[model samples]
Target: MHQDFPESRLQQLLPELIAFRRDLHAHPETAFQERRTAAKIAEWLGRLPGMTLRTGVAETGIVATLAADKPGPCLAFRTDMDALPMEDRCGQPHASTHPGVAHACGHDGHVACLLGAATLMAAEPERLAGPVRFLFQPAEEGGGGARVMIEQGALEDPRPVAIFGLHGWPSLPAGTVGLRSGPVMASTDNIDLTVHGRGAHAAYPNRGVDPIVAAAHIVTALQTVVSRHRDPLEPAVVTIGSFHAGTARNIIPDTAELHGTLRTLSEKQRRASRAAIRQVVEQTAAAFGARAELQLEEGYPVNVNDPGIKAYVERVAVEQLGRERVVDGIPVSMGGEDFAYYVQQVPGCFWRLGVAPADGSPGVESLHNACFDFNDEAIGTGVRVHCGVAWSWTRKGQLC
Candidate 1:
């Protein structure tokens, strides 16, 4: 293992990094409204010598670059900055101050880890064979922040040869890293459907078309797209999260609205499932003598880790933390991640950093839960992994 940043140095920085993570948790911001969060990050990066800061990219994103003396490929490390729009019930001293907004997904810890890496790299810029770009991105929670950052030229200006990112995984024990080669996270697409029918009096049965009945049928039939239409081996989800129809119990409403999400692991499945959903909704509604309108909003793409980049990350991780600490072939998740956008543009790898309690405690709160908080114990490991990857990737003659 190449110890560019010694364990003692990383241990000394852990307290400050934990404090920063807590501060971010306390003052959580969501989506593009991360002005204060970006400011705090900018202030921290500003103090590091030889770091170039660019704020306000894609509304609330920030990119800090540290260039090496010799020329080599630029490698990018990304961290998300937005919090989820949910209440924080952790009851920690640094619990979220913002109402209905919290860092329940451990993005706060991600930012702190990247910042720690930046601090170490900035202190010894000569070790870098090329430039290292630290991307503090906003709006990872359903806002597609990664796409916006790319559109705003965050990847340009000495474009990076590859990108790397990580998310906290509660299922894995702390200090372990989970690496996968492809389709680690699924693609997310939204479904908005409206069934139109003629209103009728409750007392009269045959007077008008019933949209409520049609909507019920539509929901039930949509499941077939996942179970019967797609291959059983393939993973897919069609969930109707919201359904609204009649305001009063006495009358049949003229229209009913249905809102749901679609998740698929492969593009072939995604496209096929979408077509099947539209067909099912329309044909089922037609069978009920009702007209249906379906709208599909494309969300993030499937987050695929480049095979070579994944191998590179795995090597660095195994070197930094022992082979036992580095886990391979973690199960794929149905959850969506905007990091898919970055990988689509450049060869990138997004791995999982374990945040579960190291002491083997049960009942660790899962992500997006009201009481979920990032494990502070994982800070040192995360920082070490990020720094190790950056250092090794930026070394001369390194290829990812």
Candidate 2:
């Protein structure tokens, strides 16, 4: 017999969830290269009753639908499936076996949690008032998987009325959940630039235009785009993370390459910043007697949370997990999430689940860190939260 509530059943299935997370963590896959990961997910999810599986969407993504006994609008629970291109330093027995690829962003835990919720819902489909969709997305690490999935019709055939997603956070203690109202994350845009000039011996610098010098000046000048060009009150970041030039100390290279990222909170600001950056790069290079080329690779848009939906999720979280474990009005982040695309299509709420251990066992293994690993204990918390949100939403009908 199933437990009276979802939390008890999630706790009972904690061992299985932990095993699934560890397996996924050990066999890491990055971006659209999640074939093995997708297969494993499909295998586990296929066991549930009333589940209809769709594979190969967006190359290596999976969408599983579970029908309810009664008819109503569908809801979605989404999680990423891709790992990062980084080494695992956690040294756990289940640490990534695939060198240079690891689940540093806690995506393994996210997948396990969503699957656990699916299991609970499947155990007693009669409890569900409507159908639910499980989105096992791929390529979240700078690949725009959600946008690709949308383009490929991941949301069609049984489009959900609203969706929910969660990320694991190290800043908060385990069992706690964080929420915010609007603009939860920033937009991401990448910049590629090349400065062209004449090459000559360093000792005879006067004989040729120095692209290195032009690139240096350009980098320094781009700093002003965030400071003087954009409104200080609005959040924006311009960082030149990579620069390459000069083969030898004695030679002034003919071309220098620069790579960076631009992050902003709004579309208008994003466009304005791109224009300003292009203007600064070309003009700055010209001032140094060099030519410049700039390519702005557009990325995920700002992630905005619907207030009414967020409030409803906040209430569900508070009810499932005690008030002490729920944090409202959490600070907005500058990071980007492809889930922004899904919410852009439907009203959705993406929140944070705390996975930090109390003993500080693996001190500060933050997201994207090579040494990072998901806290297994938090798996149950995540599972319960997702299950609670799904059951509450399906039973109560549309909250807002």
Candidate 3:
């Protein structure tokens, strides 16, 4: 028998949904490396009656779209398939099989929730009045997977007016959701600094221009890029993540390499920080008779939510989950996501699905953690959020 949309059915499907989550978690894959994961997703979606499955959209990515009997708007639900590089410490029965790869960011849960939604939508396609697209996106960890999928026209054909996505938050309790109207996430950029100097014997101090000293100066100066160069009111961050140089303690190395990450909320700040970072590296290296090269790679854009769409989704979330379960004015996450790339193309909103467990669990474990796992109880609420938003937006009454 088909499962009902009522709360009881969502509950009834828990065991199966939990199994899906574990299967994916046990065999986590990294960005652009989700081959088996994609195949399993294709198999799962194929069992649904009305789904038109498309695999290899952007190299190991899958897209299964469900069309309603009655024509209406198109709605998208995305689930990232890649896992982060981390050892498992959760000690769960389904610990990661891949050494150094773990579903620490709750991507396993994200995939399971999307599958759960597909199961419900297929069983009750009549309840769905519009076209629904299930985007099993790959490489969301850092590879700009959404941009690649969109470039291939994942949003084409029906061309959804709004795209919705959810992420697990361990901070908020299981039933509640984290939401916001504007600037929900920060933009990310990576800077690689290369300093060139003359190598010499440790005995000869005057003969060599030490790149390590120059790198040290550059790193220290970078700390002031946001504080000294940018406005205090605007939010920006420049962090030196790694510094590498010298093989031997006795001899000076010829080249020193330093890499850092830059994050900003505003475009102006993003641009300004990039320039300032380059300037600091070059100027510091020049003072020590060495030269510096800087390469700045453009990363995920900032996540800006459409106020109207955000309000509509928030309302549906409250109605289905309860008033207290829906929250607003949540602080923006410093992490970057490819969903920003999609919202950059169309009007959309990305929200938080709280998977936090009570019973005195530790505070939120940031994404990419080795021990982190997504909460399974979030499946029911997540399905309701997507289904309700799609139905509410399609109903004749309004454009919610």
Candidate 4:
């Protein structure tokens, strides 16, 4: 089906792409510490015929550029370089060699696909009518690396008119591409609360205030922030993930600590939820004769897809993988992506590339699971899609 020049060449490079992904899997690095990964990616990009490389961005990010003879708008393709801080349990031959670190999120495959696309594009530079920028960002897991990269000038010099990126999805079958318009992913915010109270013996609750009891009430009341305070139609989540208190069975600690995250699809909802959380925590703790402190950290913004850009990507997907392989109306996710930063600055579309196993296959796992492994077959799918999007925009001077 892929008879075009770059697609044909990209298909031939699947084995190499798989190898590159496995190597990244073996030596996974997390967040801003992708020094080795950055070096290797830079080395590979250096071999691309006309690409000029820039390194040491956002600590360990890389940016490469390629130009075509004809005139057109510059386009950018981005992929994350960091891995998760977790042990690999997949036990594959190329399983992570780094202890307590793994590419559980398929960032390894992302790099491979982008690399494969760059390789194909580099093989025939004349096909592109304008410049192309390859962005290898670090710390996408939670460090907001895209924001850092943008601050460090990833979008300057030859600013991109449009950009595109993808994440692997195990929910869809191997050959499908998932697309959606509007808020595709939620914004993430973190919460840290500490409740202070007088220490008391477990047997003599009347003598001193019990922070544990206050913490329990606080947690129970926090749930109401979503159930009663927020509108049912709006999507928001308030989860108290960690709670710590009490040193021994007989003694109630003077303070209880809580950690959690907030997710919302819109700024208005985010503000409302924050207000509700503070009110519930403080009031519930005060009712228990305790004082509470809450610290909220703002995280990545909600990932919104430009409608026109989303439609353009959909057309490109159909052209690359056929109408049967392209999907629409895929449900939105609560997960957060820092790619929101890039698209917030330029017109961009971020979509999903299916990596699910065929029927009856074992070892299929979701993102961030210790047993998760990037399906090699998805590498070619992603490469084809990336090449298709790039080709469509560069050659035709418009995506759709």
**Candidate 3's error at 307, in angstroms?**
1.2
RMSD of 4: 1.5
- Best prediction by lDDT: 1
Residue 136 C-alpha lDDT in model 2: 96
lDDT of 4 by residue, 246-288 (tens): 8899998899999999999998999999999999999999999
Model 1 whole-model lDDT (C-alpha atoms): 0.91
The sequence of per-residue lDDT tens digits that candidate 3 reaches over residues 78-178 is 88999988897778899898898999989888888888888877887877758888899999988899999999988888787778898988778887788
CA lDDT scores, all candidates in order:
0.91, 0.89, 0.84, 0.90
What's each prediction's TM-score?
A: 0.97, 0.96, 0.95, 0.97
- For model 1, name the residue pairs that clash: none
lDDT of 4: 0.90
- Candidate order, lDDT descending: 1, 4, 2, 3
> Order the candidates by TM-score, highest first — what do you get?
1, 4, 2, 3
Highest TM-score model number: 1
Clash count (model 1, backbone only): 0
What does candidate 1's lDDT look like per residue over 106-203, in tens digits? 99999998998889888777767688889999999999999999999989888888999999999998989999998999999999999999899978
The candidate with the higher TM-score, 2 or 4, is 4
Q: Write the per-residue lDDT of candidate 2 for residues 14-104, one digit (tens) a residue.
A: 8988998999999999999999999999998899989989899899999888983348778888999999998999889999999999999
**How far in Å is the alpha carbon of 71 misplaced in model 1?**
1.4
Reference-based lDDT, residue 79, model 3: 84
Off by over 4 Å in 4: 5-7, 68-70, 359-362, 394-397
What is the alpha-carbon lDDT of model 3 when measured against the actual structure?
A: 0.84
